[model samples]
Target: MNALSDPEPQRSIDVAAVSALDEPNRRRLYDYVSGRGGPATRDEASDALQIPRQTAAFHLDKLADVGLLDVEFERRTGRSGPGAGRPAKLYRRAERDIRVNLPERSYELAGQLLAQAVDEAESSGESPRTVLARLASQLGHDIGHQTGGSDRQLLETLERCGYEPRVEADDIALVNCPFHKLARTHRQLVCGMNLHLVDGLVTAAECPQRHARLDPRDGYCCVRIGTTTD
Candidate 1:
C-alpha cells in the first residue's frame, strides 16, 4: 500500500492520558479532571461530562480502583440534602509521588542506545533537534497503529519508550532528548549506543524509515507524517 494510504490510527496521540485507563468511560474521567487536580462530587463530574449520574459514578469507581483518582468523604449538602447526617464521597486525581522502576536490562539498553543517537547526529553534522523530530515521527507511527482518537496516548507511549515529553497545553507537547543532551555534554560511548536504540525502535515499530539518517541544514528530520503543522 502507498505510505500515504497506510493507516496508523495511533499516531500523534498523548500517551499519558491513556495510561491506567482501559475503558473509554474511565479515560474520559481522566481528561475531565486534568489540570484541575481538586476534588469533585458525582453531580459535578456528571454535569461536566454530560453523562448520566449513574454512568459517571461507574466510571469514577473504576478510576478510584486503579489509583488514578483519590477518594474522600466530604459533606455534599446540609439540612434539606444528603449531608444532614454524614459526609458524602468525593473524587480527585491522585497526586502522590509515583515511582516507575525500569528493569536493569531495559535501562542498560536504553542508555546505550540513546548514547548512539547523539554520536551519529554529531558525526553527520545534524542538530539534535532534527534527529529528535525524526524520532518523534517514528514514534507517531508506532503509536498511530496501536490506537487512535487521542494525542495523549501517543505522548505517553513515547515517554514509556524513554523519551521525556512535556505537555505544553491540551494538544501540543515537546520531548527533550536526554541522550542528545548527554552527547552534547559528555560526547562519549553512550551517545552512539542511544542513537542505535532509537533507530531500532523506529524500525521495529515499522515506521516509514528503516533507518533515520541525519539532515543537518534544516534542523528538522525527513520522516514526514501528515499533519497541519510542523
Candidate 2:
C-alpha cells in the first residue's frame, strides 16, 4: 500500500520478554546503552559505571547473549593511523531493541526530557516541526555512524529503541513503537517525544525538507540502503 494510505494498528510487546530483564546489572546496562550509542569494552564499562571490568563484561555479555546487544571483533584503530596486531571485540546496541520495561516513573522522566528537547529545538529559531526534523536527522546520522552506515542497521537500532518502521514508499516509511503501551497507561508525553526523536533521526538522514514537516500535535515519529530511493 502507498504511504498516504491508512496504516495497520500495532501491537504491544510481550510482557514476559520484558520481565526477563529485571536484574540490577542488566537494568543499569540497558540505561547506559540506550542513553548513548556505544559498543563499550569491559574496561570502559567498568570505568564509567564504577564496576570491575570482569563484572561489567559479565553483565554486558549477558545482555548480548539475550540478543539485546551486538558483539563482534573490533580491531582497535589507532588515532595516529598506525597498525595493530589483533582487533578487540566490541559490543554495541543490537538492531532489534529489547523493549525492556523499566520502572513506571521513567515515563515522567522521559516527559521532562521531551519538553526540554522540544524547547531547545524551538529556541534555536526554527519552527517546532523544523526543530523536530533536525533532531531526527541528527539521531539517524548518529545511529548510522554507530552502525557503520547501514540504513537497515539504523532501522534495527530504532526498533530496539521502540520505533518499528517498515518500508512504505521510496521516500516514505511507516513507524510503530511498542512503547505506546506506556503512553496509553501513564498519559506520558515521552512516547510522543520519542516519536519525535525517531522522526528527527529519519529527517536528519533521509529527508531534510520532510523533517521540517514534523510537528508535535500528533506526537510520535526511517531509511533504505543503496537504492538512491527515498
Candidate 3:
C-alpha cells in the first residue's frame, strides 16, 4: 500500500523495556516491589533484596525511566509534622505491558480486525467472512495505491506487518506468521483469513503476475506468494 509506516518505534521500545530486566539487581528490585499490593519504598526494597540503599534507588529509578515501574512519592510514616522529611520515593509495577517476541507476532491486531468485521457484518446483514475479506483487501489495495503498486513496496508493507518475507526466484515465502500462536488452535480460520488478506494485498498492489496461495509447511507460515498460472 502507500509507503509502509515503520514498525521500529514499538519494537524498539518493547525491546528496551524487556532488556531492562537483564540487569540482575534491577530485575530483583522490580520483582520485589511489584509483588506487593502497595508501592515499595527504597528502604523496603533494599532491605528485602540485601542490596545497598543507594544501589536499589538507582535501579528502581532506572526501571521507572524505562516504564517498567511506576514511581510515586509518599510518607511511609503516619506523622505529617514539620519535622517530617521529604516524601519517600515509592516503586510499583507500571500498568503498561511489554512483550518482546522474536519475529514479532500480532495476533491481537488480527483478532481486533476480525471481531470488528464480525460485528459490522452482523449489524449490516452481510456475510462475516465476506465483510472481513473485503476490509482486509481494501487495506491492501489502499496501501498498494499509496506505495505506487511496486513489488518492493508490497514486500516492505508485509515486512512491517511482521511477515518476514523471503524472496525466491518467482515467489515470496513468509518465514514468520504474525498470528503464530493463534493459528495453532484456530489453524483453518486464521490461515484462511491470512490467505485472503494477502491475496487482497497482492491484487490491490496490482501484481497480477503473483497471488497468495496456501502452502502450509512445517516451520514456515501457511501463505506464500506464487506466480499465477495463465
Most TM-score-accurate candidate = 3
Q: How many pairs of residues collide in each model?
A: 33, 12, 6
Lowest-sum lDDT 10-residue window in model 1? 215-224
Off by over 4 Å in 2: 1-20, 79-83, 97-230
Local accuracy of candidate 2 as per-residue lDDT tens digits, 180-230: 455555433434445555555554455333432222223133122213322
Per-prediction TM-score, please?
A: 0.35, 0.38, 0.55
Off by over 4 Å in 1: 1-20, 78-83, 97-230
1-230 in candidate 3: lDDT tens per residue?
A: 33247667766777887888899998878767654646888889989999899999999998888887888888767779798888988887665546664446786778887998999999999988888777777766665565435678878988877787878668787877878877888898788788887887788778778889899975468999988771
Question: Candidate 1 or 3, higher lDDT?
Answer: 3
Structure candidate 3, residue pairs in collision: 1-143, 1-144, 1-147, 2-143, 2-146, 2-147
What C-alpha RMSD separates each model from the true structure? 15.2, 16.9, 16.6
Comparison by lDDT, 1 against 2, better one = 2
C-alpha displacement of 84 in model 1, angstroms?
A: 1.5
Error of 1 at 82 (Å): 11
